[model samples]
Target chain A: METMLRKREDKIAIIGAGTIGLSFAALHLLKHPTCSIAIYDTRPDVHDYVAEYMSKTLAGAGVDIDSTMQRLRISAYLQEAVLDAVIVQEQGPENLDFKITTWAEIERYAPKTALFWSSTSGIPASQQSRNMQDKTRLLVVHPYNPPHIMPLLEVVPSPRTSQAVIDETLEYWRGIGRTPVVIKKECTGFVANRLAFALFREACSLVTQGVIDVKDLDEVVQNSMGPRWTVAGPFKSYHAGGGDGGLKSFLNKIGGTVQQCWDASEKDVKKGSIAVGEDWQIEVCRQTDEAYGVVDTRERDTRTRSVLEAVSCEEEVQ
Target chain B: METMLRKREDKIAIIGAGTIGLSFAALHLLKHPTCSIAIYDTRPDVHDYVAEYMSKTLAGAGVDIDSTMQRLRISAYLQEAVLDAVIVQEQGPENLDFKITTWAEIERYAPKTALFWSSTSGIPASQQSRNMQDKTRLLVVHPYNPPHIMPLLEVVPSPRTSQAVIDETLEYWRGIGRTPVVIKKECTGFVANRLAFALFREACSLVTQGVIDVKDLDEVVQNSMGPRWTVAGPFKSYHAGGGDGGLKSFLNKIGGTVQQCWDASEKDVKKGSIAVGEDWQIEVCRQTDEAYGVVDTRERDTRTRSVLEAVSCEEEVQ
Candidate 1:
């Protein structure tokens, strides 16, 4: 694992230069400065957009735009893009048919040893590669929004995925400064999205119950658990809660309270369920846009990068 | 609201100088430098412990210890603590009988205008103030653990709580550089804990189901959704997901996927439910302690403070 991680200069192929694909391109350049990236997007204009996006996003992280761009190759043909690739990251649309088609193309052209990684957030790789000739190297490598900044990468493997592929994928992501967690079993939404949606359900329930307004609910999270989770995960946080006794003491003292909270949560979920009504959703979207529209994206990205940098610098110093 | 926020020098009383109470005292001193504090605890040595804790914690936040300590008064008697107080924050143990006894004593001594705030996480303010003569002034002002650093304060009011008290409490918290979200109706766990427990259930389910190791699970959250949430809440994040159309577009495209994830989550919950088994919890605590022991608390607090300070500074500039 250590040796694999030390080898950072892998020939990477990025298929489908959409929003996620573009973000991955920037992330690869910023994280693996020595690696070369080949971007294959069906659209002719994807190269220019990716170039501009990478320059804007990576420049803030201190990446030299011209030199980094020199190592990037934009190919309109799939064979030309992935023929010599060591890792093929497919960030195509979420549709199964489109994914199967893209996977077949990559498997046909890319080197047999190259790992076939999908950026599908929800779909399992097994289903996406069902029609492919070989599926052992195919797996899901889902990332959260703005992959260049967020360090979480869910390296989910299908049943047929080989041990070497999993190990190499993990090593590569770690080498690129990503915190990759392997999903032992294939599950919908994986870990991050499942946890995210769980919280989202309750946030919606609170809004419906008038427990808090949309804006204030956001504030509550941003101020408290947001930073808390950033420093310590839930289990670690509870462990800290127990003083010297650790999680055992915390559970003994407050386990009943957690159960009670869960029980009460069921009632709240029913009482003030998140309405999927179009008008209600539009209103929420309007309010959300009003609060954090596109104009604030640059500021938000900058802040997230600053926090990550601070945390990483602290870790290095320690 | 703006004018009320300007008044910072309130005479405050903190009953029960335990962990939470001491934290509240430190927070008040750090945030409101001019406010005088009176602390009441049954334990005779609480003053020394609180003083040591405050001195150690506040020094990291660049607070002037000597000046802050001069305004702090430790009292063994309840009357002495609440006699002339304008705000009395009660952080007693989670016992109804004991809380009633303490509240009765506080009401008997504290001035009529003093706002009665309970730091109880589970019990509602209404239930706590059931035995009090004047319930109108009572409310719940629950803070996340280590109140001096984490900025979330759930300002939940009982039905009998006066509007003036609510408004003043909001203004006061904001004045102290805290983000307080008002809970419109009394509910168990309120918003933050409900959201927290919601995520915890899934986390436990994942661990139990062999989906991810406890350490890896923590890494997944600490790296991905944790920081993403610190910058933008769920609603706002989804808004960004939908290119220019905002959250409406995001929902329109992926609402069905969200529902599917929720459905899959229900099955997963039943498969690997969070067990409060004593031995299992102990093992988890041990691992957690090994990963993030007491020595790391200072580093954790420093990192959290850095993130909060950076965020607040950005907000001010915006």
Candidate 2:
């Protein structure tokens, strides 16, 4: 793999130098020790950001920082970045018009055969590729926050995306040490965020209604579902929870309670009814700040890395 | 703690030797190696169940099985079980009538000063203590499944429960190596399950909606929010995700997207509308079984323990 990456054919273009873009650059550089990375960004501080990222992730990269720096080149022009790349990863702005224009220009400049992977959290490939002449190879490969650390990527393809490209995209993410789950159908927010924010909304409601405070809610979750889901997902946990009857029995037994909560959910999770500066919102944020604001993010990053390493390889459900 | 537990007065009674009951006994015995426990249950197989539980958790308990067993005494009568217990932990059936009658009887037989703790998952202390002459000390002490290892104990006090007892209960659980979160107000399902099931219902909707499959959803969660929440709960994560703006900014930024999901949520999480024996239920169960059935629960338990141990002591908030 190292020898193969040394070839010019292995060059990959990164079409943004923001947090996600730089993270993708750093990790990809770490992943393939000999591969070249071309990062394109109009930001004046793009080079400084890359330097700062290197200093933070240097020890973890397990390779010479100088060579990585040598291999990484910044391009002001998008044409220079995608000139001879095998894969083009676009982590540009989330605006729809911006994405359409950028992708169209990327297609015109880059090799026609290059894989177009957009790291858009919410945008679907269908809309992102609308302005492109040939949308055959374009797709959405959305990662969780801090793309380099979190391995999950939502691989969503436009209807025009070729089946071969989808398979290759999944293969590429896996080869890069990512756990990619292909979305069979595209929708807003995808799977993880929809599930995450759904739970978060209910939690907000609980805190607002004075059922439980923010810090206690955090502790309750950390000690319970946080670790449980880290081991197995919802269906697996519910199935195992059912004893012998599986999910059917679990539903029959606990479904009513869940339903009761759901019935009362409207009182808590108002349909997008979060007034940004509301009193409850202010108090909850203050509580969170008091409780968790003390712990620096470095500690969190360490915790995240340790927890991910401990359980990521233990998936029972393929 | 060991020397303190050796006293004759440091005795606790465990009522009902079902799965939860036995697990509680094992962990308590492990937590206080020299403390005595009296277990009472109507099941003829109760002793066998304890013996099996000891065998399973023996290595993890780090105490001599012989000594632990000697300290644990199973009684046929509730009167004998609560004879000289400093605390009475009732893990009886979920039936409300059974709890009301049992608590009344326990109050009559046990020392009037014994701390009353009910391990009822849903039945609140308010309901469980209906027939008790004195409900001052009684409160709901609910644990996540396999109570010994998963350290979450929801310490809920009824409207009548004394504040001193609530504080004492939280301290006791913490001493037993459990992460106790005080539920400020009593509500059905409490904090953890409500948050868990809320997230779970949305996951169900996503799977049923054909947006993602069961196993891939597991992978997505295991890779994303599962590990994330393990580090910091939803509030902290969002607060950090907002860059400099905190959760208020986070709400303003992604609030619209979250609301969009919430608006569409009803079509999926239809007020606990899970048909227990429906086609989706059967198919999902089949998929779960096919995916996770082959992996024996021992593996899951081990995974749960490791993940819990990795993050339990790292709480940023008290």
Candidate 3:
């Protein structure tokens, strides 16, 4: 019933200081510098690991190291991490049983009103919170990898999730400079992954069908659809393509072709068909590292940050 | 065979000075300042229309107006347009009969060695060149909309297309600051459209399924996968996700989820099924315009150009 806007002094707790959790911590620290954070992980040396990880990745990503470090707290105990928190973000492994156990523990420690957010990309909140006493407090706040750089957060709520919790989560993410889309229904892979894997299925099919090499397929995407989609989504892009006529005209012109192509796409996405060979996998990894460097480099991170800033600024102006 | 690199003074002829043709001309002129261009269109007022279109669009895209104008020439006669062209790029309407007649005229006027490129996004060169005497010189060089800004050029060669033509086309595109990916096999919609539509199908399905709205779905993509894909394609992105273990490890972890999502995507892209309501379409177009402005604005165009420059520079350094 209270205002959905997140307060600057909100105590946020992060569970499981793995790659996703660490990345989330860095991003939260960087964006919400005034907020307090407590990180919890079962690993004995998670404190040292997280401190070192944050120092290296955050500094490389051009964050203010001293302030971010000042705001962060590491706790080996889950209760210590979540007891007084306003928002408890769980970043545990992608197992239903593990997530259910984590949520149950979080529910026991955190206040009934505390927002429970999970970073599960595929597992829905309903399944994750099946064992929890109060499911209304829990929802999925899934982020893309390297969360510090990528700005998407799919805020998926279960059927029993409270309206207030959903509203607060949406505003909370936006407050921290994230573009969060609330998934109306719990779906596997959510929207982002569904769209991504759809394209991937076709890319894999093309590679297997010998229509294009792996490297060339990557090039085709990076050069064309990637940039265009970055500026505008499929609907907007097609709307622009309609010239002055907009989406209607564009669809009228190319709807048939789209259907034809969809029909031509590989029907079954088996493990064998999607596989890009071991050599190709290794080669692509090497090429990717060579191009963008590992994790969050200054160049790659800065570019994404600048674009995000630009988009946000444009939104504010409009 | 003679060093596939394109000379600055290469005479390029542009057929059908419509939207795609004009965009290609602006990009070619901006990127290859010394290249001379001849434009031919059947419309009586095409010369004036194209001239005004180029001046407005190119200037907004931050191109050097004087040089672009200096290198461009408008001709109503087909022979005059194709006479001494090293490359004749046809941007005619997506009509097989129209393309066939146009290519026939081009082949009759142009020299045997002149490379023929069509900006047909759907129609394959083989189909268009059916009526031509020499099909080896003809191929598809499809660019995403607003070709001046988007760096992708799908260089599709038919079975009859010569190796020399393919190589020279690749080099020519590179010389003009475009990323060219050779689509080895001729399939409808080629690579880019096939991938775009695959994603679009899922997007449409999601909208229809009430999982997300049109605008929210666009935000999810532009904020997350868009920027991520801009830096790395799906294969490279997944490879990075695999961490030290690489894509193999990533697949081992989430390949099942990917298959599930792929299965969930809409199998058929029928016109009625894919259609978002007319009101929604208009609302999306209006929102897009408010965000990026209409067509080729200075802000949107410059943003795209800078991103392209940054990517190319990174590639060079790597």
Listed in order, the DockQ scores are: 0.60, 0.59, 0.48
TM-score of each: 0.92, 0.94, 0.89
Alpha-carbon shift of residue A140 in model 3 (angstroms): 1.1
Clashing pairs in 1: none
> Which candidate has the highest TM-score of all?
2
Each prediction's whole-model lDDT (CA): 0.81, 0.81, 0.78
Off by over 4 Å in 3: A1-9, A61-67, A266-303, A306-318, B1-9, B61-67, B266-299, B313-318
Model 1 per-residue lDDT tens digits across residues A259-281? 88778777777665554543345
Task: Please provide, for model 2 over B1-318, each residue's C-alpha lDDT reduced to its tens digit, 9 standing for 90 to 100.
Answer: 333345655788999888888888888888876578899999888778788877787766567778778888889899999987878999988899999999999999898667899998789899888988888879988989888778889999999999878877776776667789889888878888888888877887788777888899998888888888888888888888876777767788777787777667766655435444445666666777777664456678788777766665454432
TM-score of 2: 0.94
* Comparison by DockQ, 1 against 3, better one: 1
lDDT of 1 by residue, B1-318 (tens): 444334565678998888899889988877776688999888868867987877887785776788789889888788998988888999889998888788877888899988899999878877878778988889999999888889889999999999999998988888777888898888878889889988988887777667887778888888977787787777777777787888778878888878777777778776655555523454456666777666357778888877777777767776
TM-score comparison, 1 vs 3, better candidate: 1
State the iRMSD of every prediction, in order shown.
2.1, 2.5, 3.8
